[model samples]
Target chain A: NTSELASHELASHELASHDRTTFNPTTEHLTFAARVAWRNAARCVGRGYWPALAVRDLRHISEPQQVFRELQRHLRQAWNGGRIRSTISVFGPGVRILNDQLIRYAGYPDGLGDPQNRRLTAELTALGWSPPVQRSDFDVLPVAIETGGRTQLFEWQADDVQEVAIVHPEVGDLGLRWHALPVISNMELRFAGLTYACAPFNGWYMETEIGARNLADQGRYDRLPELAQRLGLDTARERSLWRDRALVELNRAVLHSFDAAGVRLDDHHSLTRQFVAFEERERAAGRRVNGQWDWLIPPLSPATTPVWARSYREDRELTPGFFHSRRSAF
Target chain B: NTSELASHELASHELASHDRTTFNPTTEHLTFAARVAWRNAARCVGRGYWPALAVRDLRHISEPQQVFRELQRHLRQAWNGGRIRSTISVFGPGVRILNDQLIRYAGYPDGLGDPQNRRLTAELTALGWSPPVQRSDFDVLPVAIETGGRTQLFEWQADDVQEVAIVHPEVGDLGLRWHALPVISNMELRFAGLTYACAPFNGWYMETEIGARNLADQGRYDRLPELAQRLGLDTARERSLWRDRALVELNRAVLHSFDAAGVRLDDHHSLTRQFVAFEERERAAGRRVNGQWDWLIPPLSPATTPVWARSYREDRELTPGFFHSRRSAF
Candidate 1:
């Protein structure tokens, strides 16, 4: 009885009947929605460049192998070797893709018992992803793709990824490198009341996101003590402000390296200015600019920014933007 | 009928009869209590050096003129030509001393006609206390003392005060100065249930108390914007984080100048470490260490300190510590 009507005809009839409550977007509508979502990203300091966002619509592709291939291409194109481009790849809706990001640095267990992402590393190993020949801090993680109710792994090509060399002369080949594209993959795209579960977006890195939190935070890389020692700061006492001095130097190196390598990275200072301008522009355009104070303010030297002095309203509207997906029990 | 008994005998009888409820202290008891009160000051990071505190018992001297003289002496001795010492002069109980601190900078009306403490400065001027020969950012206000219910003015001698030269090369001779002694005169001292309303206490400078709040707070000196400009930070946009950069430099100058002048000033980092050590010692001695986390943490680089990582209980115990006096309407 169901085979009497075509799938497209049935979908169109359902959409027409529930037009007020739900939406089924075409490829063109998805592309436009992605651009608007970038503009609506409240916490982003780089919204002024929303017009330059390159959104790839791949809504028809549902195979895990094909999705993996497209993701690899997206990363390579976005990396662009020291000239990172802001891009996003839209996958078919309702596909459950596992892993926070298509690309992440693998954190292995060092046997000596340092804090590492043992669970994640183990999971990747079980899924047949090989670790780098030499275990290093900056090893790239394999992509995990789930489609047709099945999970598959894909290896990232090393050459396609771009990394800037940290500028500290004393660091001595510890190989401090950050992958150029910061693609947030796990977030769901909601547009016109329809959810695209597998859309991933990328933006150029903000230096403090790497220097202040990723490396400086005690939980992640925790490089402050080592950097302080290398910089000849007195680590014996906190009164010397060794950690603060080290943090400033680390942030400086991140900015310098990115700039020297011609990578499109924004320093917190520059980003703050850009955000202020964006706010003004949005206001002039008769749009209410929403932001989260904590997210808008960079972690390093926060009070130095104008955002710290002002409060922002949290906008919870869920259209033409990305939303965090609920975690699966698995 | 009341004149039949001697005052000391009557006070002793009342104390002996009501031992569990209310109690009074002799001059000897007051001196010891003052030392203990300082040790119990929750907000103070320099309590480890409480043994070195100089307590001047002036409770017997209730005359306004005598109190003023003692205050002058306290300031001079505490300044000690940049080798600052912690000192306190106890005034008689229930005496009304009007100012929060013995020393505060005068705020003047600019061309913008903004609300300044012009009334206070004018009142002091009328009382024959001269303003600085040249009006400057850190001009010290004349001391106001009230004893026997009569208010009197006492001019602070410029020679006794020491000022640190700011490190920024471009900020030439802005005449930035802070009175060497931070004598908190208006707070009440409670020991063994008796209240001394006019007890004033001083501590060695914590640089953040000067650089971070006194100089940087918007309502007070509000010097960050000017300092940022002088430091050659781009203030054309909010994102430049000029304020943060300027604040760091300002703190640096304070520490450097204090060190150069042989002043007993402690930077927040050193103070935090010292506080942590103090807490450990108190714990080992079975004394509960009470503190307010907000007050204990330095305004600048707060999270960099270990104090920021932990919580402290607000001790509600009234006795054996200093307490904030209720503000008088007049």
Candidate 2:
């Protein structure tokens, strides 16, 4: 039924030009060694591995259009311009799917990642899922890290400075508008903010996310607050209390989080540290002793001066030593 | 090199007795009613399904201690504890895992569901796999849902209250203490003041993380000043605002969760509808106009105040005709 290039063609590809005997079937255990694999198939066959197995060309099986669309979607997501990655791994195996990238994902029959909803354990067991297993797999999710991937550069020169809005959390809604910061860099990785750049691009383009990370790690942000010491970074002042104000502002954002889980922008990794530090600083600033602790608790504060349920911006700050001890009583 | 009786005995246990001798060596396929199986001995070889798959049976694998300890730890994780159910189908073409519990999940090789992660695509092709190329040869994933697997219930006999501390988002180091309200019904699930439940008795449990969801679905929350109606909930008249006050006082603890995704208290069913409503109330309140905009868009009264960001207090009662479209912009 099919054209044969001669039985020797098959032997030539595998063995030398030796004698050509058709075949015999055999069963043998096989070893596995691959960076990635799909084990779901093994379960159905009722077997594990079969070494010296046959291989087929899977590329032929795919419908071309489907593959193209998928790649497009992945690209849009990887770069936050089009599809913004929102889901954080809070339920089910705690997958950190930033940019929707998968490092290690095995076939999970049902979605167990819902923080609010979960699968019944009994049902899953009947489905052949043996959880509480100690096998973990991972794959490096791709990011615009200059250290690992190559960068593309963009040359879009603007005619004038553009202003963007910064909506403050407490001021109600009016966001302060400021000129876009400049992105001035000669890095090849930045192709008009695609490589490792997010929205606020002025003109400075670095190599990658790792590149930005390296700068921050190398004291870039540390040096930044000092540059604005007079502008707003001055922590020593009380009236314009720059330090407290900045700390307070940062705290406000966190205060604005959903639940105590602190659901804020995942991209803002350094946010937690600042929030924690400000809190520590506040506690360090004791409440001059005779602060109103009784009235500030629940119903007392509700009627007098309203306290937002989601915030820690209370009327007073207790010394850490005092707070640690007195909190239970309060 | 092999023992006759031992091999036959093992094979016999797997197959029917009379069928063993009657099993033709030349037979290429086997049938059980409508269930036709690929008759190749290939299953007898390879990694061996037992080696590649982890079943809780404990007998099929080794180091029972390792398995037990791991399960003990993983069960506490939100993902493992939360999983409701999953089903895996290992087709000849590929492995399919269908998880349909709280959220939906179906994973095959990346190429199956996701186009980008084609690790399975390559591996499958190499394994000479295809989608039913021939009906005679077969495949399938070996997974099924089981009974008596797991169900969590948080049964409380009385309103035995407890306490939990939360770090205020803005307040920093000085922490806030919220009383844990343990009313089994609407009190904790609908209103607030629910830290982790103390279970039926005083039993120790493990943990995991979750998010805010039930708050909205249950309709317990509303926009800011609107949510303030909580103040009106008190039968204790001295303070008409006691309800709102109580919510804030126990805000952290009130919103404390009993997520099914993590290690659950064996005694709690963790009602979904009510559980999600409280979180939603806060979210709904947050969605309302930002508090500062009250000046631009004044609330029902100059004194209504913006409780939208904090607790949902109902103080705004704007007349339907009170649109201020003609007002000058501030």
Candidate 3:
């Protein structure tokens, strides 16, 4: 909650200088900061496309309703009919949202209903947002916006959200779809010693992020076994490496579907090549590229990538970049 | 080289007490030291079977020819017709062998011939050891035993080595074979401040030590692409995860072949379970188990093992343990 600001604290601060009120950055500065933030993202492999980042400056608005409307616009513009563009929308400082992302799958009381949306679904339901139908796995969660000492919910527009249907011969529809834009909403942006608490950013997905980790990790979608079974790989023994085989197919389907839909996503090999180029450019500029080796390496075929062989400096200084805020238990 | 000792320094010590002459350990002490050495092997996952170690004390002999004969005996006893057992042969101190292992594949000048053993083959060939016929992939390397300040080569007997045939339907017999026991020939065994520099040790294989790294690593056999092609995996695309699928199957073949041949080997799952039990036993005995997290976790299906989740103390302490001697460049 924004707490005392809207309740009584604003009265005492009303006589303060206008510098505090004009602390929010202009559109040009916001755009530059967003681009630099992308460049400084140590774990991102797609930083070669940093110059293409689009920034939406919504820092002038303080209302939760208006913030949500801008978020809808950001999603629609970034989605771009599957040709996803890296984008960010900066809501004004002092407003906070507890959720990490603007969209997430919800969990239900029964078995994992919408494997991705469960927690966010509960959070939205607790905030008195009603679903039009029984919750599904692909449900897009409403944004939890806190401003002026109060928290409110804003439902996403159906027209603004675009999902690519995963295509596979044996797997059928499976109803698997990821919201086009992954708007990281809860991270704070620190630039020139000023903190923007509600800056949401987006980038085009790397296929491995969706296929290898999200879909294959046991605690997440856990789709490997199902995919393996559908593909007729022997699942009775671990030696069969059914999981590994299925993981490849799952990743293949993701890349194929995204490419077929014309979404701007990268495969691991191309990303590794781009990262190598990024390293060379950083070296040419007399800057040592700092990165986390584990994060920089792709999940699948890790040994094949050059990033796996090299060491990286763990420089986690927070300035002109994004930093994770204190997470709220959902 | 023994240097001063062979050049008349022994004459001065010859008049000294027999205590200096008989510095070699007794058979019982050798057995105890061998067990402790296996327990201290940081990279080994089969240490739970340390109690069953069979030690061959050949410390009484100092001749290179005699040492080679004993090495043959060690191989046969350790091989034991595919029901392999952990074993070690303690060669007398003051003798240094240049080769790392008693057996290795011969690498030819042509493309990727016997990827694991080429260097040892060259070393032996330089010392006037001739191949009986055209050099094969699974060439049993001759022991280069150094004694009396001189190094000599000793060829292994045909009856001493045993190999399990890998049975994979698609790959057929690619002529891949490994010596029944991995006789680590150059490590020093330090017990109660006593250093035995030429104490060779052997242990049963952990399938991944063969299949995952030795065969699958790019610098080694690198059989994944061949296996993938044979298995009809789509190698044209990285997203297909063909390499990962082939790796799993290769690991499976290793486990299957070892089990079929009645060789005393363990799969990663069983090894992990045994390691967990070993940890518990160590805890119960008031000893904290020292292990390397990276070495303990198997390469194939690493996350599925408990060893991957836990941390280990990096213990480099060297008492009652085996240590690698300075390696001679081949």
Among these predictions, the greatest TM-score belongs to 3
Candidate 1 residues A191-220, lDDT tens each? 656878888888898888877777776767
lDDT, candidate 2, A150-238, per-residue tens: 22211112322222332334443222222222221111111111121111101111111111121111221221133225234534422
Every model's TM-score: 0.68, 0.18, 0.79
The alpha-carbon RMSD over the true interface for every model, in angstroms, is 3.7, 19.7, 2.9
How much lDDT does candidate 2 score?
0.21
Model 2 chain A: ten consecutive residues of lowest lDDT: A27-36
Query: Which prediction has the highest lDDT against the true structure?
Result: 3
What is the per-residue lDDT of model 1 for residues B242-271, given as tens digits with 9 covering 90 to 100?
Answer: 566677667666666667667778888777
* Per-candidate interface DockQ score: 0.16, 0.01, 0.27
- Per-residue lDDT of candidate 2, residues B176-224 (tens digit): 2222211111000000111111100011111100101111111212112
Q: Arrange candidates, best DockQ first.
A: 3, 1, 2
Judging by lDDT, tell me the better candidate of 2 and 3: 3
Candidate 2, position A293, lDDT: 20
Over B55-88, each residue of candidate 3 has an lDDT whose tens digit, in order, gives 8787777777777778778888888887786788
